[model samples]
Target: MLSGWEFIPFLTDYLGGDIHAPQEQFWFLNNFSDLVTSSFQNVCGGDVLNGRSLGILLIITLFVGWLFVKNDATNLLIYVLGVTLALCSTTFIDWTSLSHNELIMNTIGNIQFPFRLVPYAGLFLSVIASFVICNIIDGITSNNYKQILVIISFVLISVCGYFGTVQPALDRITQNVSEKYLKKTESKQTIPDDVVIDKYNYNAIFDYLTQTGETDYYSEKAYNNATSIINNIVYVNGKESKLIAEYKPNKIIYMIHAQKGDKIDLPVIAYKLTSVSDNGKKVKFNQSKRGTVEILARTNVNRIEVSYKPIVLYYVMMFIALLSWFGVIFYQVKNVKNRLIY
Candidate 1:
């Protein structure tokens, strides 16, 4: 959101309450009202001109206007004009009061703030300004001195623009990394194989798992109880029975070496779509308190499989999307061939 005076850097410090410093209730009330009021304010106050970045904007506007008048370049003119109008309407219009005009208000409300339009204004102005520069160069007589001067000016402007935008972005990234990651404290506790101790502290573990294409299941209760279930085997009374398993998003395979009535608690979050089977026969599964799938081992049962069957509608939609993409590719190829031949 904007505060109607965002263009003035000093006003931003006063308008948006500082994130680090403690503030009074009145400070919050004043700034909060400014945010909401700017979204619906129609008239620009006397201070508005002083707060606007109008110098560069004026130069771009003059170039675009010259193109519009000299060549009557309708395509470029219409685009620039449309973006200009959008920028003005967003900044100055009383959008919240236009409830009667549902379509316009709804569309503008989705954007949330008028200041976001400034980027598009800059982009369109840059494109039209480039065209105007090219036109000026074309109109000049074949003078080496004039041509070289124009080229040098363009290069300097480009270099200045690049450093002005990119250096600040790079500095901000360095500052954030130093504050969040470099200053974090180290931990010494040994985490269990089945447990993710502190998710925020072990974010890199989740990131690695995701990158390696493993399902990173997150259930507050389910993951916490996974360690307890495996440690204490309640149903089976046999020798040291160990269970080996392979996990998948929709399927799981387990090799259990346990006696009849022995149960193995899987480390996956239990869902209604999940089904369990043992040695080709379907078996009933119970969800533990932590929401993990619990399977009881039967006599001579060595292999167990748990699968999640996707719905029919999912496959149907995927098929339709695939066909639509193929149709689009075919159409584009045909159009390109036709254009080349003609």
Candidate 2:
């Protein structure tokens, strides 16, 4: 992407030696695009909470006992606030119940969480300091139920740290490149007669998402998802059926249109239909002998891509958020010059 900066020169030459043309067309991005890219990055950027690996919980427990075991109102207040924020920012909880048996995971997936809308989820990073003041418990202090809970809480933190910060940035970068270079294009207006419009059947795709799953999703409200799609197939002369399917499809369908005066052989139908995946191939049957033929209105296809990614960067980001927390603490101490509660 950095090398693509040279394209500006080529564009400038093409635009009649106007040097600024290259900068405008190829190199320089609009202010709005830059702003959006910077501001709304948390949902699409690096993971912020993968710090679960840092063992901050271990150090925190030790420090709390050393500094505030005797009694410190400031410490207690900070600890309580940090605990509340950590729980709010992380963890998986039932936002609501769906159907009779399903519990919806709503906490982490929620967009309304603080710092969830910016780079690395942009927390003030004060949660740790808050805990430092109230560092009353941890595996080091009490390894019973409290220890387990603390570890579990960190797990949630890791999840939020990963998704809100790192994952979103990766997604955004990939999408940016694709949009910049490999933009999606609508096919020609007129689909070939032999072309099967199987993808045109969108309703069927949604049906599969709802009915085909043996395991219910995090939310029973999956069909109405923003990323979800609806498929519908209006088969000509009732030759095919309509299906409302999920955005992600698992079934393959095709609209077959046999040419006039062709022998509609069974083997040919199977052979020809198989090739639909690679090209716009059609199976032609004998139109005259009660032979069936039709143009397919595709409504659905299997999910060809995914929005989530692996955990490599998520791990790195965990480090950054963790360190960032300390940075925030030092900044506060240096600036405020007072050891008081938030």
Off by over 4 Å in 1: 1-217, 226-242, 247-250
Alpha-carbon RMSD to native, per candidate: 15.9, 21.5
- Lowest summed lDDT window (length 10), candidate 2: 20-29
Q: What is candidate 1's lDDT per residue for 1-342, written digit by digit as tens?
A: 122222333232223422122111111111223323432331222122212222343334534455454556664675566456444534345544553466665455434445545445555655566556666775773464566577678789877755653453345435545334422223322322223223344433322222211222334454455454333222233233334345444566776666787766665555555678888789888876556677778865557788865445545656666777788899977875664455
Alpha-carbon lDDT, every model: 0.49, 0.32
lDDT of 2 by residue, 3-122 (tens): 333344234332342111111111111222232233234333233232221123322432343354236566455445443343333322222222122222232232323323222222
Model 2 alpha-carbon drift over 4 Å, by segment: 1-70, 90-93, 97-342
Q: Model 1 — TM-score against the truth?
A: 0.36
